[model samples]
Target: MHRCLAVPEIFSEILKDILPSDEPRLNGTLTSDACHLSLEGRPVVESSEELYQTLLALACTCKRFLEPSLDALWRTVDSFWPIFVALGISERDLEEMITRHRNPYYPRRNPYHPHLSDLSEAQFKELALRLIIDADYNKAQYYLSRIRIFKLHAIPSALLWAVGELSRKWGSPLLPNVRELHLTPPLTKDYLIFCGRRLVHVSAPLSADSPSLTTHSYPNFDSIYIPADNTKDTNDVVSSFIKNLPPMRVIDAVGCNSMPGTLEVIAAMSSLRSLSIGKFPDLSSSPAFLSPGRLLPCLQELLIGDIDLDLCTQLLYALEDPSALRQLHVGYLSTTGATLQKFMTTVATRCSPICLTRFTVSSNGPRRSADAELPYSSKIQPIAVQPAALQPLLPFVNLEYLNINVFTFNYDDGFVESIALACPNIVTLCLNEHPEYIKSRNLTLRCLYPLAKYCPRLESLNMGGFTFATGPGKIGVDGLSRTWTHDERYDVVPGLSLHFLNSSQVGVIDRCLVDIAAYLMDIFPKIRYVDYHPLYFHIRDVREPGWNDWK
Candidate 1:
């Protein structure tokens, strides 16, 4: 063996790199919250079995490879098969267990493989009871102790009960060092027993009737993630589930429905620092609470999606003291020019002017050409957003990230000037949502001047609808004679941080590419990537005479 291989720590890390990363999901599909909960029935994909077999073979080949291979193999477990196999449970016994126990809830689709119907609380109970007699305790302890993450979406209740029973018998939790646990629906209080002192993150399904765990069960956990698909989960039930938990720092309930009493319940959780919900409960009907800052006092990050203008406004109003807020992401917004103006006004009034750093809003604009022909589509026209709509947010001078992805805004020089002057610390400014759906706009390449001149730390800029400029006030012009007067400081150097400029969404006429290139290079000296793909533009060929100048 090599000298580096003699070091178990280094070799263990090498082996770990070959294994799958933590919480591998099925079909690469992610939960709405991006929480990692393993799929039911399918734990280890066929692709990974070859690697696991190699590791197993290496472990058996030499004493030097045993510890490291075992460490890498058992670090993150998705199913109970590994544990059962590690405990020296024979295939004959597993087959016998399945044969002996039968449940009416699930159909026996495959007799050879214990399918969904084969797994039930009663069957798991039998397995748990059998484990008490036949489990290889020493071998189980060796492998179970190595598991740091256990993510299983379809866990039988009896399996957890067995672990709890064994934990009580053994005087230690089964997964002693497990830090992250993602369990699916129908969680019981008994499952809390598996959560040891090291557990810090939990993603589980919760419902109103779900058994609640004690706050002290796993006090170390700081983040709790509940999925969006649990139709049975209501705000009241989620609130009840959270109320009993130890002071959590982060709670993500993306796409979860909010009830009348949900806000009060969330407001009372003073320890919460981050919250992500699907919709905002109607604050108008709910009982009035105390002062604004009093609710969600420590919350710093908030994400709300699938919301309308009215609910969005109400939720903003609910946050009185948003001095701690750092990030706000609103998705699927449905609003008009005036409603959007009101929403922005509400945001400026309710949120902390200084604390907010990152802001993103992506609207539910028409995705397809047919969507525009819908009956309700005519009622809400995509009107050009005025400077007044954004005027309210100008107070947030400390903003570093601002992404306004809506079809209503044709980001011209005026809008750029206002934003650049107001939020000089902006790092990323993305104005267009649908780059392919080009709207009629009078904006030209001159819009980039204010951004390059003012926001010195800016890096990424996405002005999707603006066309190349041939008009006056083009770059390198000395006079401030246009409609917008410039300061006396003509010698202000452009920020070198900008490396990405995406103008692929614009539909512009083919013009003098040399002039466009020269103008951009004068102000933005370090722009390395320029995406001028005409998504909605007439010039489809990238190899066109004028387009090659940008390359």
Candidate 2:
């Protein structure tokens, strides 16, 4: 019945409450800075928890809203429990779900797992049959075919088998034209891989697959995402899947067997381009892993983690003819030794520097432990990056992005001046000290003048503290004194993602004002994003991605 007045307005209002903060974006006017899957700053759909009750009310309100309202409700199903719970099963049968720790779990597993595995196949089928036969719940059955994403992480295989059986009896594939597959432990151990030529993105954990799917190859495989795990399970399933994979470009084995043996298996695949290993917890302590040095020839991007000073030196020396490598994500610690200095020299002299455009050091490792005895003492300390250590990378003038989060705050004005000469092509720069550390009293805007003057291409920057002094005030320029014009100054970017809360004493941001907004914008004319938390400002080239993610 088209009897309700202002239905569209009421419908939009309902959508606002269901969505989290992305309200203005559904119309596609705002930039997609939140998407993590973008390649060249393209906009991708953002998925959040759906408001089931609100959308259901609209579906029942009128025949006109049935299709659109139901589409929004069932467009994405992260798990199977929602469909079952809504099917209005008996209280005793559904009571078992409360035991799972994840109470009212919507998109993920519940906390108190009632162990659905304890149920017999007949018990599972009984519940499945009820859901299929129930007319009220199954009236919107077409929505099942509308499901574009189905995440099977931690979902029981018996339940999947039940759904498959029910779908077969209905004369349709369980999930036809599904676009993405996120596979974790215990996904249908008996059934074969479901066919779907539409699927493009897949995130697979280093776990076992169903027996029938061990040698199965789904259609149109391009990118594979393997999450981090510490288990030493046999890689037979992973090996078989990769062996049968098509000419894929990206493979992320974050915590899987990232040893040389795994790389040996991956290197054989000539189609492989990017290999991300950001979670190798034991990369530093063991010397055996570095031996099979520089194996992947066609590789372009390498993201490694948990490497220390000595291990870094050894790894650099092992990488053979890394001319194709463009992006490097380094995760290691600093030392009082000359390891960093040696690394820069080797990367510039030994390898092809022209292709090395992006270099980043992973931050937020096990934090430095504070000392118990001395109230102000820190148990562990950071070995800060020195200016001299950056000498080797200076020759790589083609460098566009540089991110090192371990540099000390005591950098002199000349440190960045040298950077201006070394890599004038720098576009994105991120240098931050641990937030827990005391803000350097020496950090001043005097150093940043070099980037503004020399590296004209520099657009995006993310760092902890620079110009701790209040503005508009007198600041040194090339050792010369100059007075400016504001009450307070803050270099915090214009994004909610960053933390603007400084210690009471005032670190980089203090007594800030909206008046200085214009002046700061004038300095970085080409900058697309400034992630200074609690105060976000987006400028020209709004299509550019946010501060992180090298690509």
Candidate 3:
């Protein structure tokens, strides 16, 4: 054994790398965001039984590794089973308690909780007390004291009864030092009792019948994550819970429904730094219901998933002082080009330009069947996507990522040039036009010239639909840059950063595949992948020399 192994910092880092933080799991499926609950405390890492045994052996074998080994072993646990096992509870009793308490309300999903018929309230309390009395208190405390993060997947009534009894007996919580807690479905009011004085954050689900948590539950609470509830009319329950909570620093209600005062309740939280909501209620008609308070003064990131143009405009109005905001994302159920233009105009006037960096919006409605398109009115005129729609965003000089997906957009070389000059720091620019609802698109292959010329930092580009320029004369970069500025003419070569080119619905020009490939290579010398439509392959053979040359 080396002397460096005795160093606590080195040993802890090694242990953490070997047993990383536990990835949140919902019925065995991994979530999309691993660090979703990382705002309040450290990530809860699950140490496997085998690793725990190894650490125990090392601790028993050597004095230098004893304290560090024990600390790593009991830092975080996936469930409460290990605590009972450590207290000398028999395996037979544990199995019986779990099997008999399978919840009947959601038998298919939550099979570890009790049904009403299995045990009456008194009977459940009695059994929980017996188990608690039979277990060794000293042994349980030895391990529980070292635990910092705890996750309860399923809470049986008996477990809650036992926890309440233990808290009452000792005059404090069983896990008194825990800082972060995570819970799964079937969440009820009883779970709030576990919020010890030191606890700072909690993550749980919200259901229609679930009870609200009071402000007195935890004195140090700072952040919360309420997973979306699938039940009907859950807004009232969620709103009541939010209304009762103390001022929070972060609130993430991604898939939850919107109520009348939901935004108002959130806007009143002056300390909020990050806020994400599923939708905004339509309050355009009743503007008086909203307060005139300074909303989210410390806000940094705002994400809205599904909203209409009217409510979105109202939300901007609610943000009286948005100078601190950094990111804004808005997704629409459906909207027209005129509405989108008006919304952009509002955003330009409302949101912070200097601090904002990322702006993303999606307006195309949900997918519909082919037969469902009959009711769509052709009387509504089509609007061609122009540089003016994006001109308002040019004030955000620090913008790095811009993504826009709407019904239709007519792309041209001038449109590309406008974006390239407006946001020179942009890293990812995606101008996706909905393929289902096609309109006139005049973009040509020459549009790539401006991107490679002006946006030197750009790495990815997607022009919805485009065609190659046709002519009797040769097509080259020189002809495209004839009107370039004196400063722009210095670096006439392709950009070294761009690697991905996404161009679909490519219309062939004079069957000049060789010239097209050469021109693309000249503009984006570092291109690694080019995405084309299936129809492109049908028009031109995949085995052609032009394609092979590009590869």
Residues 436-506 of candidate 2 have per-residue lDDT tens digits of 65355354555665665566666565545555453345333334222332212335432212122335434
TM of each candidate vs. truth: 0.61, 0.58, 0.64
Relative to the true structure, how large is the alpha-carbon lDDT of every model? 0.62, 0.52, 0.61
Q: How far out, in Å, is residue 503 in model 1?
A: 15
Q: How well does candidate 1 score on lDDT at residue 515? A: 48
Off by over 4 Å in 1: 1-75, 90-139, 155-165, 230-236, 239-247, 285-287, 290-292, 306-320, 331-339, 342-354, 365-383, 391-400, 413-429, 433-437, 443-551
lDDT of each residue in 268-386, candidate 1, tens digit only: 77778888777766555554563334467677888775567766666665665566678887765457787778888878877788889888766742221111211223333455676
Q: What clash count does candidate 2 reach?
A: 20
- Lowest lDDT 10-mer window, candidate 1? 27-36
Which residue ranges in model 3 land beyond 4 Å of their true spot?
1-77, 86-129, 132-134, 146-149, 284-293, 306-311, 334-339, 364-384, 395-397, 412-430, 438-551
Q: Return the clash pairs for model 1, or none.
A: none
